[model samples]
Target chain A: MQYLFFLLAAISVITALVVVAAKSPINSVIALVLCFLSIAGHYILLNAQFLAMVHVIVYTGAILVLMLFVIMLLNMNTIVEVRKPVITRILAVVTGGLLFLVLLAATKQGLSVDVPTGFDPGVGLVKRIGMSLFQDFLLPFEVSSVLFLSAMVGAMMLAKKDGTENVNLPPSSEPDLRQAGPNDSAA
Target chain B: MENVMTAIRVVPLEHYLILSFLLFSIGMVGALVRRNIIIVIMCLELMLNSVNLLLVAFSAYHSDPGGQVMVFFIMLVAAAEVTVGLSILVLMKRNTDGVDMNILNRLKW
Candidate 1:
């Protein structure tokens, strides 16, 4: 189990680095997909087989594919010169480094973790999750459906183009819009 | 509980927490440094992934199923977040023909 976990962790870390480093957006997204897969592998090693599958299905399968499709649809392969000012970039790096260092310091010894040995890890199947969600979390469950519907409608509204803006074009006395009548009304 | 800590293996839990912390930091950096709206949204998802890892780890340590329920709720929210986030990104893309988030500053500046 240790070996399997280590292998998966190593894979996940390397792919995550690749996701950050790759210059192309498409490559970065692909690397991120790989990172998610390795994380799913860790889920399996942790004995959450159902979560492992759902993580892959929901995140890697659905979310990432949506990302990839968006990239392709946008055709954003062309160069987009990064616009961040140098000082801001430096500050951002420093802040990220500082935050990470603080987290590492606080969690350095991993805090005293205790789990009762020999306890059943419980059933983590989809059916079990569904039952709990529908039974105990029923109110929140129904609310989430309404939330999702609103999000979809909001997204559509954001993406849609509104028409019917009347434009008189200044009555176009310019040559391009001038009359094309013949005769000494010259050709 | 006291005796459990005595026999508990320290390595695995530390490792998982450290990895989650690292991923969360990376996501934070991505959010801070990237000027692309879509990429920023993706980074947010990464941050959420790190949170999910923390929840799962806690659930394992406590022998409780409630954290898993929270994880499911987060996924619900995440799915909604991404759908709206991406739609807005697409809208931004159409408006500007590119996704430089700095374009938003024009409204103010």
Candidate 2:
């Protein structure tokens, strides 16, 4: 069990580093998918089977694929990213290191807090989580549906062709008015 | 099921905390240093995942369903955020012909 935890931790850390360090966006995306998979493994190890499955589906399955599609659509797979200045990159690393140090120090003091509630292995099951979601968190669950709807609308508006460009043009112009026709009706 | 509990019990919770923190810092560094907007966005997702991992760890350790429920909400927000963010990325690419963050300096006064 300890070895499995170490293995998953190592995989997650390495893949996370690769996600940051890989030159190509595609490679980074692939590495990130691997990293998320490792995290799911960690979740399973931690006894959160439902969360583990959800993490795999929502993160590696959905979000990363969405990112990959966008990368491919933009043809960013071939374009090499320009490196930041060496000083800037070094400073970034230093800043992150400092943040990590601070976090470590903050957590170091509380390394062994007694668990207030006894461990329930079944707490992570889908049935338990579903009840919690539908009962205690019902309001947030409903509100999140609203959030999703708004996000869908917002994404469509933002990605629609000539959406922002039309907004910038004068409302009186003939071509602009014609172009805005479809958008207005759609809206 | 019994074996799963014993398996996780072998590892201390602090290790999970350290692992998630490391992942978060790596994401932060990537976001800071990367020039490509998409990669930066990916880094942001990485950070989010690290937090989710921590929350799940705590949830499991404390036997609290609330934490896992919170993770669900976080995922929901994250999904919505990514959709909007990527659409904006597509828009930026369409307008500028490149994904370089430096090109966004036009917004700076």
Candidate 3:
């Protein structure tokens, strides 16, 4: 069990790295999908079966497809992408490394707290999660639906053609591409 | 099933924390360093997933349903965030004719 856990962790970490470092957006998205799958495996190992399934379905099924559609729609390519200053890239790495080190140190301290060693196997079950969602977290759960609705309307409004209110924002000076059409220099 | 539970317990929770920290940092670096807006968004998703993993681990170890419940909420919010964010990205791409993050500097003076 320990070995399997390590293996899954390794897969997840390496795939996450690939997601970060891959030059192509498509490649990064693919790596992210793999990373999410390995994470689902981790969830299963952790006995959060319902969460694992939801993670797989929501991430791999809904999110990945949405990303692919956007990628295809936008027609992103690295050919035109200008590299950032070396100093900025270096700063980014340093910042990330420092964050990792600090968090690792915190984890070392966190380990000092005695967490209950055994798990209640039933907590991860779908029935348990559903009951909690409806009973204890019912308000937040319902609120999230409102959040979703608002997000949908907002996206639609933002993406609409001739939407001048948001167009007043910077970069509105650029030609509205909807008039030029979708395939206009889509590289 | 019983054997799997024992196996999970054998591994310290701190290991999970360290792994998630690494993943989150990588995603942060990617978000900071990458020029493509799409990739940046993907990195954001990666970071969110790392947190979800940590939450699930803690949820299992503590035998608490709340952590997983939180994960579910996070996923829900994440989905909404992605929808709104990608729409904005699409808008950016449409207006700018490219997805490069640098092009967004028009927001500056």
Candidate 4:
């Protein structure tokens, strides 16, 4: 059972490196999907079945596809290898190493590491999570959803129309009376 | 089941930490080195997944499910982020004709 953990950890690390080092965005996205799947495997190992499935469905199924679409839409696979200015590269790598150290240090204090009691799915299954969410963590969950909804609405508005498009709108002082129904006006 | 469990188990919290560290470093390198916006986003996702792996490992070791619950929420955010990010990427591609981050600095200043 524990060897499985080592295997997964290895898979996750390798795929992640591939995601970063892959020369093309398309290749990177594919590698990223594999990385996500491997992480979901770890989730299942933790007995969080719901999270494991959702991790795959949301990230590998939807998000990676969306990224793929964007990459293809832009035809950015022929990526230009832009030389990252040396100072920026050095700063980024240094900051990244510093962040790793911080996280490790913090983790040493807060992380709970015990030997696994074996892969017991029944222990912390989805039902258990639901119980906890609805019981103790309800308020915070609901508030966060509201926040998410607002973010969605704001994003929709930004996508639909803003000041930039007004420059291209036909110069018609007459208000278009067609703005009546749900679809037309909304779109 | 006991036999199976016994054969494959090794414990050194340090290994998980080391793996997470390497994954995170790779992600940061990608973010820093890659100029294409899409590649950078992919790298960011890689970083998030690295963190998720760490959380799950810790949770499994401790026999706690709460960390997994957090993983769920993180996935939710990542989904929403991708949707919004894709829309923005599309809009940017339409306007700018390329997704290069360097060219996008003009949008900044």
Candidate 5:
């Protein structure tokens, strides 16, 4: 059982690294899906079966498809090769390493505290979670629904195409692409 | 089932913490170094997942339903964030014809 835990954790970490470092955006998204799957495995091992299913459905099913559609629509499949100064790249790597070391150190000290023995396994069950969600966290749950509604509206407003008529467009906000000066003729 | 729980408990929680930290750091590095905004967004997702892993681990170890419930809330917010973020990216792509982050430096001054 411990071996299974280690194996799943290793797969998740590797796939997560691939998701971050993959050159192609499409490849990165695919790697992210695999990483999420491994995470679901972890959830199952933790006995949160319902959360595991939700993780797979919400992440791998809905979110990944949305990302892929956006990528396809935007035609951003190819890696955009931008040259960054060597110093900044080095700095980023150093900072990331430093953060890892700091976090690892803190976590080592944190694990020294003894965990209470004999946990109730039923707490992670779907029925328990549902009851707690409605009873203890009912207000926050309803508030989250409101948050979702607002996000939906905001997304729609932001994504809507600008009006075709120039009359409605605020003056000087839109750059004039039609103006080609004498400098263009010189070329 | 009891045997499985005992086996899981035998493994120190510190290992899970270290793994999550490493994953989160990798995501941070990608977010910092990558110039493509879409890849940056994906890295952000990676970071969120790493946190989710930690939450689930704690949930199991502590035997608290609250942590798992929080994971659901986190997923909700992550989904909403991705929706808005991708919409903004789409808008940028429509206007700029590319997704390169450096090209966005026009507003930096």
Candidate 6:
């Protein structure tokens, strides 16, 4: 069990680094998919079978594929990203390292809490999570559906061509222009 | 069931925390340094995944379903966020002819 955890952890860390360091966007996306798959492995090792499956499906299946589609559509796969200045890259790495250090120090004392007694291995099962979602988190669950609807509409509105009109205006201001243009035309 | 119990006990929770923290930092640095907008978004997804892993680890350790439920909502929101973000990316590419973040310095077009 320990070996599995270490193996998954190593895979996740390495693939995540590759996701960051790869020069081409396609390579990064591919590495990210592998990283996410390893995370799913971690979930399974932790006995969250439902989460493992969901992670695999939602992340690798949906999000990564969507990213790949966009990359392919834009023909961005062949474009090697222009590197930032060396100093800026170094500064960014330094900032990230500092952030990690702060987080580690903050959690150093808090992470040693005793494991709660009466560990129920079944708590991670789909049935319990489903009940909790439908009962206790019902409002949030329904609200998330509303959120998804709005996001879908917003994405469509943002991505669709607006013809030649309002080509220069941001999306947020374009609606106001549309609202005002009819009045001007009528006058 | 016994196997599951043994598995959870085999590794300390601290290791999970360290692993996720490392992943999060890596994502953060990627988002910061990457010039391409799509790779930046991908790094953001990486950060979110690290958080999900931590939440699930805690949920499993504490024997609580709440954290896992939270993870579900997070995934939903993440999906929505990615949809909108990528659409914006496509729009940016269409209008600007390039997806480089440096070109987006001017707020007004």
In terms of DockQ, which candidate is stronger, 1 or 6?
A: 6
DockQ for all candidate structures vs. native = 0.36, 0.69, 0.67, 0.46, 0.58, 0.68
In candidate 1, what are the lDDT values of residues A24-134, reduced to their tens digit? 788879888888888776665555556778789889888889989989898876757486787887888788789889998987765887656775445345666677777
Weakest 10 consecutive residues of candidate 4 chain A by summed lDDT: A171-180
Measured with C-alpha atoms, the lDDT of residue A103 in candidate 1 is 91
lDDT of 3 at B8: 58
Two-way DockQ contest, 2 vs 4, winner: 2
Q: What is candidate 4's lDDT per residue for B1-109, written digit by digit as tens?
A: 3343232245466676777787888898888877878888888888888788777666655666677677767776876786677677777766666777877778676
TM-score of 6: 0.91
A1-187 per-residue lDDT for model 2 (tens digits): 8888899999999999998998888999999999989888888887888989988899888999999999988888777678899999999999999999999999999677565445688889999999999999999999999999999999999999864484544556888878899999999
lDDT of 6 by residue, A78-127 (tens): 66667899999999999999999999999998767678778888887889
Q: List runs of model 5 lying over 4 Å from the truth.
A: A164-187
Residue B88, candidate 1: Cα error in Å is: 0.7
Residue-level lDDT tens digits of model 3 in A3-79: 98999999988998898778787888889888999999888887788998999899999998899988877777534
| Model 4 ranges off by over 4 Å | A79-81, A86-121, A161-187, B1-9
Off by over 4 Å in 1: A108-110, A164-187, B1-11, B107-109
What residue pairs are clashing in model 2? none
Model 2 has a DockQ score of 0.69
- Cα lDDT computed for each candidate against the true fold: 0.74, 0.90, 0.86, 0.73, 0.83, 0.90
Writing each residue's lDDT as its tens digit, candidate 5 over B1-109 gives 6665664577777777887898899899989988888888888888898898889888878878888889899999999999999998887877776888888899788
Q: Sort by TM-score, best first.
A: 6, 2, 3, 5, 1, 4
For the predicted complex of model 6, DockQ is 0.68
What RMSD, rounded to one decimal, does every model reach?
A: 6.2, 6.0, 5.4, 6.8, 6.1, 7.4
TM-score of each: 0.84, 0.90, 0.89, 0.78, 0.88, 0.91
TM-score of chain B of 5: 0.90
